[model samples]
Target chain A: MINVENLTKTFGAKRAVDGISFSVERGEVLGFLGPNGAGKSTTMRMITGFLPPSGGRISVGGHDVVDQPIAVKRLIGYLPENAPAYTDMTVNGFLSFSAEIRGLRGDAKKKAVSRAVEMCFLERVLHQSVETLSKGYRHRTCFAQSILHDPDVLILDEPTDGLDPNQKHEVRQLIRRMGEKKAIIFSTHILEEVDAVCSRAIIIDRGRIVANGTPLELRRKSEYAGAITLSVRGVSASAVTQKLSQLSSAKRTSVIAENGSKVTVTVFPKPNMDGELTRAVIDATQVWQVEELRTEEGRMDEVFRSITMPDTAKSPESRVQSPQS
Target chain B: MNSWANIKTIAKRELVAYFASPLAYVFIVIFLLLCGFFTFSVKPNLFDRGQASLSGTFFFWHPWFYMFLVPAVGMRLWAEERRVGTLELLLTMPITAWQAIVGKFLASWLFLGLALALTFPVVWTVNYLGTPDNGVIFASYIGSWLMAGAYLAISCMTSAMTRTQVVSFIISVVVCLFLILAGFQPVVDFISGFAGPKVVDFVTSFSVVTHFEGFQKGVLDSRDVLFFLSVIAFSLFTTGVILRSHRAG
Candidate 1:
C-alpha cells in the first residue's frame, strides 16, 4: 500500500509536480498517464524516495518517506526511466548485486535472482554482459532487477518503453500477474497499455491530475460515447443529416462526407439514449437505401487528448505556451 | 552490523567493476612503471645513492604519484555513478549516504593498497643489497597507504560535488596539490610573512606532506596517524554531505 498526500516538487521557477495526492492499494495496478514533462517521472522518484519532495508527505507500507527513507525504500521495487543499469555487468551479476543490496544472502539471494530471471524471461542472456544485449533484453534485465526482492510496492517508469509488441505483451502479462499481490504504479505515454494492464488510471498534465477513472469510465467521457455514424446511399447529404436531426433521441446531427448519391452522417444522441437512437436510425433508413450503419464505443484516444490538452483543444496555438509559462 | 553487509555489497561491486574495465590494468601498469622508473632510472637513483634506505628514493615518489593516480580512481567513484544515472539506483537502496560514501572510498583505498603492495620487489631488492631497516620500510608502506586514503577521500568528495569525471579529476588534483604543498618550506615561509607562527603551524598541520614526513623517518607517531585519519574522516564526511545534498537536488 502507498499513500501520497499533497506531494509537490519544484525546481527553481518550475513546478515539476504541483500539489497532488493519490493512493495505490495492494493488488491494484494504477496506470500513470501523462505527456512528456508532465511530472510522471518526478512523482515516481518522490514515491521511491530517490528525490525529496518540496512539500507534503509520502508513506510506503506505513513508513514516512522523509523520516524513514531507508525503510520506505526497503518496501519499494523501483525501475527508473530508461531502465538505467550498469552496462558492464552481466545479467546474473547485476541481479545478484541488486539482491545483495536488498538484504538477501546465500541461497535466498540465488533463488531470488533465478526467480526474477525466469519471470522477466531473462534466462537466456543471464550470463551475457548487459551492454551486449539488445535494448529489449536490457530493459527486461532491469525489470528483473526491480522485482528481484519482490518488494510490496513496485513503481516502474515506462516499464515497456522500448520493447517489441510481443515483449510488451509479455511484460504486461507479467505486471498483471504481479498485480495480484503488489501495489504497482507505472507511468507511460502509451494509452493502450492502460487498458491492457491497469485496473485504474490516472491522467496527469502540467503538474496536475487531470483525470482519474477506469478505462471504460474514461471512454464514456468522450463526446463520441453515444454517437453513431450512418452511411446512406440514394440520399442527399443534407437530406440524411436532416432526417437524423429530426429523431427524438438525436441531440445533434452533422454530415460527415458525401460521395455522389451516398452520404455519411454522424448522429449524436441525447444522454442515455443511444439505444433509442440506434433503433430510430434503423427505422428511418428502412425507406432509404442504407449502405452501412455503425455505433461507436467511444474514442479513448480522443478523450485522453482532450483531457490532457484542453487548452490546446479550444485555442490550439494560443495555449501552446500555457503549461510552461 | 548489517550495515557492514550493505557496505560490503557496494564495495565488492565497485571493486569488481574497477577490475572489469581496462582502466584498472592501465592504472596499475602506469603506477608500477612510474614507481620503478623513479626508483631505478631517475636522479637520486636507488643504486647511485649507495644507501640502504628507500625513504629518499621510494617513499619520496608516493605523494607525487598519488597526486594523480588517486584522483583517477576517486574521479569515477561518484561522478561516473551520477553521470550514468546509477546514483539514483544506488542511493535509493536501503543503504544510507554514509555507507555508500565509505564503501566507495574503501574500495578505491583497497585498490590503491594493492598497487602499493606490488612494489614489494623494491623491498626485497633493498634487503638483498644491504642491511636495510625493515621497520622503516614497514612504517613507510603504512604511511603511504594512509596518505593514499587521505588523497582518495579528498578526491571522492570532489567527485561527489560534480557529475563530470574530468572536472572531478582536475579539481581533485588542484585540491590535493594544495594539501601537499601547504607545509613546504617555501610556502610556509611565504605564509609566515603575513601570519603569526601559530597560524603558520596550523597551516602546516593541514599539509599531507608534513604529516607523512614522520612515517618516512621510521617513526610510527600517533600524531601523524591521527592527522592522516582525521583528514580522511573530514573529507569522507564532506563527501557524505555532498551526496546527501545532491540527492536532495
Candidate 2:
C-alpha cells in the first residue's frame, strides 16, 4: 500500500535520507530500525506529505505524495515522534477536531471518537485537558487521533517512546492488532520491539539501509548460531574443553566460569549441528553433572552492532571466534 | 460542497473554542468599555465645537479600537496552531488553504462584530440625549464592521508569519498604525512639503482613515466599499499564499 522509490531528503549539504527505497504491502507491519539521525522521521514526513522529498517519488495507495498529496494524506494516518498535541484542548475535543478534519461528522464522527477513545483506553480522561495528562496518556491521545479516521495506512514514528513498560506492552499489543489490517511502518530504535511486533525489519544506519529481512532470517544470514552454556560439576574446565575440542561439531569452546566443584562452559556449535556433539560431550565427561544446557538466542541488538560496526575495527579475539561460520 | 463542509467544520470548531475560553467575553467587555469611555469623555471634549454625531464619536476611534482588538483576536489564528503543533494536523487535512483561511477569518470577524455590537448602548444613549442622525449611525456601524474585517485580515496575515502571539500582535498593531497614519492631516502636511500636494492627496486617498471617514459621514460610496473589501481580500489571499508555501516547504 506504500511505495517509496529512491526517496532522498537533504538538509543543506547533509543527506538525511539518502536514496532509500522500500515498499510495504497491505496489512504488513514493517519496523524501521535506526539509530539517532538515521533519517527515519524524515522518510516518514516525506511519505505523509509533511515534508517534500529532495529527490525521487513516494506513492501511497497509488497516489503520489507530491502530486496527489490530498489523496495520499487521506489514505495515511501519521503519529509523529513527539506526539505533539494541543495542550489547551480536552482529550475528546482534540479527537473530535481531528475527526472533523478527516470528514467524519455527526453520528459517524461521534462513533469514531468514542471508538478511538476506547481503543487508546482514554475513556476516563476524555474530559480532562491534554496538558494535564501524563506522558503515557498524551502519547495515547495522539495515537487515538491518528486512528480515529481509520485510514488505510498508518505511519507511526516511535509510537511508544515515553510510555511506561506496561503501557508499552499494551500499545505493542494494540499495534500488533492494528497491523493485522493496515499497512504499518513504525520507526523505532528499540530492537526487541521489532522482534515482538514486526513481521519484517529494515535496519538503517547513517542515512542508509544496512539490512532488511525477517528477524530469524537476519540471524541466519548473520552466521551466528545458538551457543550452549553448560555448568558441569566434578570436572576441570581444561579437561572439559579438551574433550569438547575433539568433537567435530564443536566450533569453539571456552570456560566461562569456575567454582569449587562447578564449571561453566560455553560451546559454539557449527550452524547445522546434529545431536552428535551433545552426545559426545555427555558421553566423554564421566561424573560430570550437566546443570545447564541451553542455546544462546541471538538478539537484534547483537545483529545491529555486528552489521553497523566496521569490520576492520573488530577485536582480534572476536575475529578468531568467527561466529558466522 | 467540499468548501462548504470545510468552512463549516473550521468555523464550528473555532467558534466553540472562542466561547469555551474567557477570551470572547473579555474582548467584548473591554471593547464596550473603551468605546464608551472614548465616546462620553474623549470625543465630547475634542469635538465640543461640532455637533456630536455617531460619525464623530464611533467612527473616529474605530481604526484605533480595531488596532488592538483585531490583533487580540487574530494573533492566535495561526500562531496557536504552530505553538501547539496542530498546524501539522490542520495542513494534512484534505481541505484547501482558501477554506481554512476563509473559515478562520469569518469566525474571528463575527466574534469581533459581536463585540462591536455590544456597544449599542452608547449608540442608544446618544440617540436618547439628542436627535442623532440614524442614517449616520447605520453608516458608522457598517464602516466599523468593514474596518474590523480589514484589520482582522491583516492580523491573520501577520499571525501566519510567526509562532509567537506577542510578536504577531505587536507586528499587526504596527502595520495597522502605519496604515492609519498614512492618511492623517499632519503626516499628509509633512509629506506634501516634500512631495507635491497632488502626490500627498493620492497617497492619503489610499489610507483606511480616509475611506472610513467617508462612510462615517453617511455616504456608502462603491469606491470606499471596494477599497475595504479589497484590503480584506488581499490580506486573506496573502495569508493563504504564505500558509500554503509554508506547508509545502
Candidate 3:
C-alpha cells in the first residue's frame, strides 16, 4: 500500500536520509528501528508528504506523493513526532476539525469523530481543552486524530514515546489490531516493541538502512542464536567448565554467573550444530544437579547493536541477562 | 471549488482559535479604549470641531491605529503555528499551502473587521449630534476595512517567514512605517530634494494613506480599491512562495 524508492533528503551539506528504498504491503506492520538522529522521523515525514525529498519518489495507496499529494494525503493517517496538536481547542473540537479537513462532513464527520474518540478512550476528556490534558492523554488525542478518517495507510513516528507502560501496551495492541487490515509504518527506539507488533522490521542508522527483515530473521543473526544456558547448583564451577570444554562442536563456553556452589554457564554452538550443543548440555545436566536449562533464541537489542554499531565499539557485556531480556 | 471548502474549514478553525485565547479579548479591549481616547480625548475632538462629518475624528485615527493593532492581530497567524509545531500537522493535511495562507489571512482580517465594527457607537454619536453625510461615513468604513486587509496581508506574510511572533510584529511594523511615511508631506519633501516631484508623486500614490483619502471625501474610486486588493494579492502570493520554499528546504 506504500512504496518509497531511492528516497534522499539533503539539508545543505548534510544528507539526512540517503538513498533508501522500502515498500510496505497491505496488512503489514513495518517497525522502523533506530537510535537518536537515525533519520527515522525524517523518512516517515517524506512518506507522509510532510517534507519533500531531494530525490526519489513516494506513493501511498498507488498515488504519487509529490504529483498527487492531496490524493496521497487523503489516504494517509500520520502521527507526527511529539504528537503536536492545537492546545487551545477542546478534544472533541480538535478531532472534528481534523475530520473536516480530511473531507468528512455532516453525519460522516460526526460518526468519524465519535468513533475516534471511542477508540482512543477520549470520551471523558472530549469536552476538556487539550492544553489541560496530561501527557499520555495528549498523545492519545493526537493518535486518535490520525485514525479519524480511517485512512488506508498509517505512518506514525514514535506512537508511544511518552505513554506509561500500560498505555504503551494498549497502543501496541491497537496498532496490532489496525495492522490486520491497513498498511502501518511506525518508528521506535524500543526494540521489544518490534518483536511484539511488527511483522517486518527495518533498522536504520546514520541515514541508511542497515538491517531489514522479520523479527525472527534479525534475531537469528545474533551470535547467541541457538545458544544454551545452564545454571546448576551443587556443581563446582571449574568442574562444569572442564567437562564442557571436552565436548566437541561447542564453539565457546563462557561463565555468565558464579555464586558460591552455584554457577551459570552459556554454551555457544558452532554454526548448524545446535543439536550437538543441546545434546552435550543435556548429558552434562545428567551428571550434575541442574537448576535451570534454557535455550537462548537471541536478543533483539544485541542484534540491533551489532548491526548498527562499528566493530571497535561493540559492547557484548551490555546485553541484558534477565528472562525477557 | 474544493479549495474554497478547505479555505473555509481552516478559516473557521483559526477564528475559533482566536476567540479561545485571552489575547483576543485583551486586543479588543485595548483597541476600543485607544479608539475612544484618540477620538474623544485627543486634540481635534469630534465635539470640539462642531462638524457634521466623522472624517476628522473617526477615520483620521484608523491609519495610525491599524499600523500597530493590525500587526498585533496578525503576527500569530503563522508564527504561532510554527512555534508550537502545529504547522507541520497543518501543512501535511490534504490542504495546499495557498489555502492555508489565504484562510489564515481572511480569518485575521475578519477579526479585525469585527473589532472595527464594535466602534459603531462613534457613528451613532455622530448621527445623533447632526445630520451627517452617511455616504462619506459608509465609504470611509469600507476604505478602513480594505486598508486593514492590506496591513493584515503583509503581517501574515511576515509571520510565515519566522517562528517568533515578536519578530513578526517588529518586521511588520517597520514595513508598515515605510508605507505610511511615503505619503506624509515632510518625508515626501525630503525625498523630492534628492529625487524629483514625479518620484514623490509615485511614492504618494503607493502610500495607503493617500488612497484612503479618496474614501474620506466620499469618492469610491476603483483605483483605490484596486490598489488595496493588489497589495493583498501580492502579499498572499509571496506568502505562498515562502511556504513552498519551506517545504522544499
Candidate 4:
C-alpha cells in the first residue's frame, strides 16, 4: 500500500534522509530502528507528505505523494514525532475535529470518535482539556486523532515514545492488530518493540539503511548466534577448548571462565551451519560431568549495538566506552 | 462545496480556540472600551460634534485601533501551531494549504468583526441622538471589517514567518503601522512637502486609510474595495509561500 524509492531529503547542506528505498504492503508492520537523529522522523514526514523529499518518488495507495498529496494523505493517518495536539481543546473536541477534517461527519463522525476514544483509552479524559492530561494521555489523544478515519495506511513516528510500559504494550498490540489490514510503518528506539511487534525491521544510521530483514533474520546476524555454551566440572579450560576444537562443525572455541576444577567455555560454529555444532559440543562435553549447557539465541540488544556502533563493540578499548562493561 | 467544508472545519476550530480562552473576551471588552473612550471622551466628542453620524467620531478610529488589535488576534494563528508542533499535523491533513490559510484567516477576521459589531451601542446612541446617515455607517462597518481583514492577513503572513508569537505580533504591528502611516494625514503631508502630487498619490494609494476614508462617506468605490481585497489576497498568497518554504526546508 506504500512504496518509496530512493527517497532523499536535504536540509540546506546536510542530507537528512539519503537514498531510502522500501515498500510496505497490507498486513505488514515495518519497525524503523535507529539511534537518535537517524532521519527516522524525516523519512516518515516525507512518506506522509508533510515534508517533500528532495529526490525519488513516494506513492501511497497508488497516489504519488508529491503529485497527489491530498489523495495520498487521505489514505494515510500519520502521528508525528512528539504527538502534538491542540492543547486548548478537550480530548473529545480534538477527536471530533479530527474526524470532521477527515471528512467524517454526523453519525459517522460520532462513531469514529467514540471508537477511537475507546481504542485509545481516552474515555476518562474525554471532557478534559489536552493541556491537563499526563504525557501518556496526551500521546494517546494525538494517536486517536490519527486513527479516526481508519485510513488504509498509518505512519507513526515513535508511537510508543513517552508511554508507560503497560501503555506501550497496549499500543504495540494495537499496532500489531491494525497492521493485519493496513500497511503500518512505525519508528521506535526500543529494541524489544522491534522484536515484539515487527514482522520486519529496518535499521537506519546517519540517513542510510544498514540492515533490513525480518526480526529473526536480523537477530541471527549477532556474533553469538547459534553458539554453544558449556559449563562442566572436573575439567581444565584448555582441555575443554581442545576437546571442542576437535569437532568438525566448531569453527573456534574460547574459554569463558575457570575456577577450581570447573571450566566454562563456548564453541563458535562455522558459518551457514546449524544444530550439528550443538550435537558435537554435547558429545565432546559428555566426557566430563556436565553442569550446564545451552545454545544461545542471538540477542537483539547485541545486534542493535553492533550494527549501530560497530567501531567500539569488539576492541580491547571498547570496555572503556561501553556502558555494559 | 467540498473544499468549503474543509475551510469551515478549520474556521470552526479556530473560533473555538479563540473563545476557549480568556483572550477573546478580554480583547472584545478592550476593543469596545477603546472605541467608546476615543469616540465619546476625546475632543470632537460625539455629543459636541452635534452629528448623528458615527462616521467621524466612531468609524474614524477603526483603522488606527485595528493596527494593534487585529495583529494581536492574528499573531497566534500560525505561530502557535508552529510552536506547539501542530503545524505538521495541520499541513499533513487532506486539505490543501490554501484552505487552512483561508479558514484561519476568516476565523480571526470574523472574530475582529464580532468585536467591531459589539460597538452597535454607538450606533444606537447616534440613532437616538438625531437622524444619521445609516447607509454611511453600514458602509463604514463593512470597510472596517475589510480593513481588519487586510491587517489580519498581514499578521498571518508574519506569523507564518516565525514560531514565536511575540515576534509575529511585533513584525505585524510594524507592517500595519507602515500601511496606516502612508495615508496618515501628517505622514502624507510630510511626504507631499518634498515629493510633489504624483509621488504623494502613489504613496497614499497603498495606504488602507486612504481607501477606507471613502467607505466612511458611503462611497462604494470598486477601486477601494479592490484595494483591500488585493491586499488580503497578496498577503495570504505570501503566507502560503512562507509556509511552503518553511516546510520545504
Measured against the true structure, the TM-scores of the candidates, in listed sequence, are 0.95, 0.89, 0.96, 0.96
Give the per-residue lDDT digits (tens) of candidate 1, residues A154-259: 9999999999999999999999999999999999888889889999999889998999898888878876787888788888876777777788998777666778
Higher TM-score: candidate 2 or 4?
A: 4
TM-score of chain A of 3: 0.94
Cα lDDT tens digits, model 2, A146-181, are 999898899999999999999999999999999999
What's the CA error at residue B142 for candidate 4, in Å?
0.8
Model 3 per-residue lDDT tens digits across residues B105-208: 88988898899899899889889989999999999999999999999999988998999999999999998888888998799889999998888899998899
Clashes of each: 0, 0, 0, 0
- What C-alpha lDDT do the candidate models reach, one value each? 0.89, 0.83, 0.90, 0.91
What fraction of the reference structure's interface contacts does model 4 contain? 0.91
What is the model-wide C-alpha lDDT for candidate 4? 0.91
**Candidate 2 RMSD to the correct structure:** 3.4
How far out, in Å, is residue B154 in model 1?
1.2
Angstrom error at residue B4, model 3: 1.5
- Candidate 2 local lDDT, B144-220, one digit each (tens): 89989999999999999999999999999998998899898899888988898789878887789999988888999
Question: Per-prediction DockQ scores?
Answer: 0.78, 0.48, 0.83, 0.91
Native contacts matched by each model: 0.73, 0.54, 0.84, 0.91
Question: For model 3, what is the error of residue A301's alpha carbon versus the real structure, in angstroms, after optimal superposition?
Answer: 0.8
Which candidate number has the best lDDT?
A: 4
State which candidate, 2 or 4, has the greater lDDT.
4
